[model samples]
Target chain A: MKKLLKYDYQYLKRTSKFIIFPVVIIILAVLSPLTARYLNEILAFSLGDQAGMFNFPDPVVFDSYVEYLSNLSDIYLYVIIFIGVGTFINDKTKGLYPLILSKPINRVKYLLSKYMTLSSLIFVSLMVGMLVFSFYTYYIFGEVDLLNVFLLSLLYFIYVELILAIAMFSAMYFKSYITAVMITFAGYILVSLINVFSFEFLKYMPGMISSNIIQVISNSASTPDVIYNVVVTLVITGLLVVLSITKFKKYDLN
Target chain B: MDAIKTVNLSKSYNNTLVLKQLNLNVKKGEVYGFIGKNGAGKTTTINLILSLILKDSGQVFINEEEIKFSDLAFKKLIGYVPDVPVFPSYMCAKDYLRFTLDIFDLGDSMVNQKTEEILEFVSLPNSTKKISSYSRGMKQRLAIAQALIHDPEIIIMDEPTSALDPIGRNDVMNIIYKLRGSKTIFYSTHILDDVERVCDRIGLLDDGNLIVQDTVDNIQKNFFSNKFYIETKNEPKFVLKKIAKINQVQNAVKENHGIVCYLEENTDENTLLKKLMEMDENIVEFRRVKTSLEDVFIRLTNEKTT
Candidate 1:
């Protein structure tokens, strides 16, 4: 276990992508509220007189936050996928796998270290981004609900971890970074397709939970929707993570 | 007791036998040279001993403990250097050493002192650059440094000197030779001269079997031709026939410039020289040539096939 931690720390320290990707996510997070504030102006300019054609009730700070979460969900998920794929590919391609295997570390501990490092990084970065978005939204809109933002960020954290699990699985299953990315994207597509089947159980698909979390934060649904999304997200995340760990254990490092 | 032993070790990849019923025993503190051709299962044998690859059948005992792949305690006793040593490209030499030390759970004081000592031993003490910038030889030296850092009882190197130039090879050889009495070094290489220079014993692998295993001197002595070269001004054919007639001479074959007489066992060297001189007083040169490790390897492998 100690060896695994040491190797994990070493890998995290050495890879620039690990540091850079999170910085990019944090930058996006910091800018999310600003982008939300300008959404009204940009929409007005682009639509000109047509902008009034689609009017609704007054948009609140929660609406700007909903926009932030949606944008982050769609784009930063891809960033998470990119960084996760890199973590595994770099080790395999750089010949570090053989060296690590030659050490006294076991395969289980090795894979666990990678999963934990990536998941922790993703969760921490997402939380920091959510905090920044929350602070900016409150500053610009003069009113913000801390409890709602915290709940939204927690739900998004689950979603990011689910994506991390999938990304890690893809990385372990395939040797090429491009292939792993394609597979992860394909998995996202599959989850989206499953949502279209209209089965109530399919609402619990890991990807849908993220969208539902955003919906809950926007107050677009009742208390039942938020509860269902949390439960489904936890269950799916648990299953996928367990599956990844099992597969990683038997994987031949060669 | 043997420091390392393998019994009937066999391994196959994709239905092709790479190592077949091989056996080896390396005594403690002995420099055992595993000599084989490029594809002759030297690496496979080493991998089996290191538990990097699962053996199809066999038991490997290290320090009298049966090695289990799941239990890495046995690994703490070994230091391994692969044909190509790999490290994280972003790590400076010092950090890399620290990382290794951390995994092995050594103390900070010991790690710092040992890292400096080993880096200087490999002549890389001042190299603060990331490992990716190191040359092949430098990487090899660093590999050796890391392998020795933990103070393992055995060091197993696979083709350690293959990528090295003469100077690098000599440097590595010198380091290995300096560890002569303290550590047991098991290295596999096709470089016969390096084996001759450092290895106390050698095992020659040919066609998936250990065709020869013995001390360097014993191998040379056992397979070496006991023929004495005799140069004489007189017609060598007459001397050959005369030598052939003697009971002490097994066979006398004529050469272009001289005659070579194979002596029987227990034949007195002084008596043979006296007889040869009496037969032809114009003898210019008479000497026995010793067989080299290469000659023994070739003879044993050739004998195995035919």
Candidate 2:
């Protein structure tokens, strides 16, 4: 297990993807609220004093965080996909698979170490990014709703885990990182975009749960909707993990 | 008991067969050299023994235990070094060795002690560069270190010197010498000279068959020609043909510049010379030479030997 973890750490540290992940998020976190606060000024710089033609209400810290979190669809999703798809597939290309699997250890244990290490890194980045974002948001626009933030963060965590599971399984099964990312992206878009704000029946989806996160942070989401989404996310992630392990057992891994 | 044995082991890819009923034995405390051309099922056979690939038919035994391919428990009995080894690019040599020891479940003190010993054995005890920055030779040495970390009974190497430069090859050859009699090494390579330099017994794998297997000296004696090279003023073909009719003479062949007469084991050279003198008066020179392993390999793989 110790050797496995050491390898896992090596994977997470490779290519400095972890650094890139948090750096991008940190930059986005600070920029989101800054954009919200200086919307008129930013617009004025672009439009050359034509900004005076339009007026709006003052920016709120909560709205800025919402926008920051909303970027989950574009920035965070892409970064995490980059992280997920290459963990194992790239090693296959570089001729490390045979050396590793040739050992006496079980392949599942090795795969789990990769999975857990990546998950932990992603978790740490998200938590640390949230902390920094919270501090900035509070300082710039007074205090944030700590309880609401906690609840919404939980929902987003499940949502991310679901995406991560898809990304990882696709990489393992397809054996191509690019194809894995493409498939995971296609799945994410299909699930997250279909009747996004208008669908009531399919709100139990992991994607739908993420979309409903605004309501959760705003303290307006119903308890049952939250419960159903969380349950479904866990179930889907669980199923994907089991499927991965099953395929791994018989995988040629050549 | 033999340290390694395979009974009628065979494998195929798609509809094409690669290894066909390969029965091999490697005794303990000896270096068994496995020689074959590229794509001659050397790697495939090694893969089967390591249980990295499932075989179509046959059984593999390590230290007399039947191998269960689906489970990797059998791997505990062997250590393997691939032709080109790679490691976690993020780690330096010391850390990588430590990690290897950990994988084999060594305790902390043992890990440290073994790591130090293995690194020292590989002559890279203080290398601080990440594996990614290492040269091919360095990686190969580190590979040797990692393979020895587990102290396995059988050490399987696939062309350990095939990919190294002259200096690197010498380094690895020296390492093999150091391991002589200390471990049972089943090494595969196309470098016949390396085999001759270190291996005690050799198994020639040709077209997936154990074409020839024996001790070095025995194989040479069994497959190679023990022929006298004779030069004469006139054409020696007629005299060689006469010599070929003798009961003690195995066969005779005409070379470009001389006649080569294969003699039976008990036939004396002076006796053959006297018989040749009686057959031909123009004999000018007579000599005998021992054939090399390369000649034997070529003869065994390409044609039936006398």
Residue pairs of candidate 1 with colliding backbone atoms: none
Worst 10 residues of 1 chain A by lDDT: A245-254
What ranges in model 1 sit over 4 Å off? A47-59, A220-243, A251-253, B227-230, B234-282
Candidate 2 lDDT, tens digit per residue, A1-254? Answer: 66787767865676687587678777876776676677756777788767678775677766876877777557887888877777756776677766777777787787777778777777777776777777777777787766666665667777777777887688778866678889989878876785456666677877777657887777788888889978988899988877887777776644
Best by lDDT: 2
lDDT of 2 by residue, B1-306 (tens): 799999999999987889999999999989999998888899999988888787889999888888876677767667889988988777788887776667777647777777778888888747677889988888899888888888887789999889899999999989988999999999999999899999999999988888988988888766655668887777677666676787777777888767887787777788888886787557777888676788778777777334
CA lDDT, every prediction? 0.79, 0.79
lDDT of 1 by residue, A147-232 (tens): 77777777777777777777877877888889989998887777657656777777666657656766676678667766776677
- B176, model 1: CA deviation in Å? 0.8
DockQ of each model vs. true complex: 0.46, 0.55
